[model samples]
Target: MAKAKKKSPSSIARNKIARRNYDFIETLEAGLVLVGTEVKSLRQGQISFNDGYINFKDGEAWLVGIHIAPYDHAGHLQHDPDRSRKLLLHDHEIIKLQAKSEQKGLTVIPVSLYFSNGKIKLQIALAKGKNVHSRKEELKRRDIAKDTARQLAKY
Candidate 1:
């Protein structure tokens, strides 16, 4: 057999709530600013994204609420779990995201994080929070899709 292709260095930890809470509008890949211990923790997939989000302010993009667990081997320089992390993005992308975020009800949220070419990258999404009805509709649609897939497999 031919050798299997390796999976891309994708999504170490994903924010499961982000998908059900918002319609996936657009996704952008951005670099992360991490310290030594934090980077080590992330590489081991010891991070959380449930409440993380990107903030654009004063011409900078920051990732807030992402939690990188303290590296067990740290000797006294452990990083803070809730500290804000800077994100690296192109100037044009920043401008566009800034413009888009100004739209009513639109927000910037982090979808996932992963390693790319030995460096950590974040997947951020431009999203709008779903109201109760919208979330219900999404659940209904997902159930329908699941049923359809199951029926197709039976043939």
Candidate 2:
């Protein structure tokens, strides 16, 4: 009898700016449609989340503004670095996301990208943008927590 292989998930890249700029309401994992060269680029950690966000069109979700750099050795057949890629999600999930995103100040954004069981997956979140004052308060809270932890450790 053949044994099933274990699936070891690995992280590729994260959108740190998304964490600092927004407050996440909910998060979900999603599949991505990518070509060979794009996958190679991702494996090389050649991706960026600058201005990236999820856009729904024709009842489908598309990943926009993310940049996957061309594979260094792909030559002339390389994929476009900035093309909008479709996200693979169930019909019900799409509907739910679309409805939630329609609310004012709520938006869908990609939080991170990784590989699971040899397939690439995206971690996306439904989030609301944080105001400057709220961001400042969050930073202050983090600093205070760190200080308290440090003081406790000293005793």
Candidate 3:
């Protein structure tokens, strides 16, 4: 009997740097606050998740600097591409994030966005930044691991 191939999540879309820059401590899904033109733009996949981040203000989560391109078909209702938008997380989750965020160096970062259950969703994370030296060390370790795997496959 032939085995079924497992489908990877990348079959959708992913932000590679979100994984590389910050260790994926945990992931949470929240509704993205969107305007009509922005939703249309997102459906067309004309959005940029780069340079996006989640931050807490007034005890609510907000996503900043993500670019949702203007809808091409919109005649005069263009939306801001680099707007700071609110993220809709549950009250309980928001409370948790508020507590965790107060600790030094802890931050909420936007991981990615995708459509689920026919609605757009944003994946956000709780993370601690990595220092430059640590980032370099992680790269070195990854290279060594790749080399080791290659050598083993040849045997």
| Winning candidate number (lDDT) | 2
What ranking emerges by TM-score with the best candidate at the front? Answer: 2, 1, 3
* 41-108 per-residue lDDT for model 3 (tens digits): 87787877788887778878889878888999999879889989998988899989878878888877
Q: In terms of TM-score, how similar is model 2 to the real structure?
A: 0.94
Q: Which residue pairs show backbone clashes in model 1?
A: none
How do all models score by TM-score?
A: 0.87, 0.94, 0.84
Model 3 lDDT, residue 33, Cα: 80
Clash count list over all predictions: 0, 0, 0
Q: lDDT for every model?
A: 0.88, 0.97, 0.81
List ranges where model 2 is wrong by over 4 Å.
1-6
Better of 1 and 2 by TM-score: 2
Better candidate by TM-score, 2 or 3? 2
Candidate 3 minimal-lDDT segment of 10 residues? 6-15
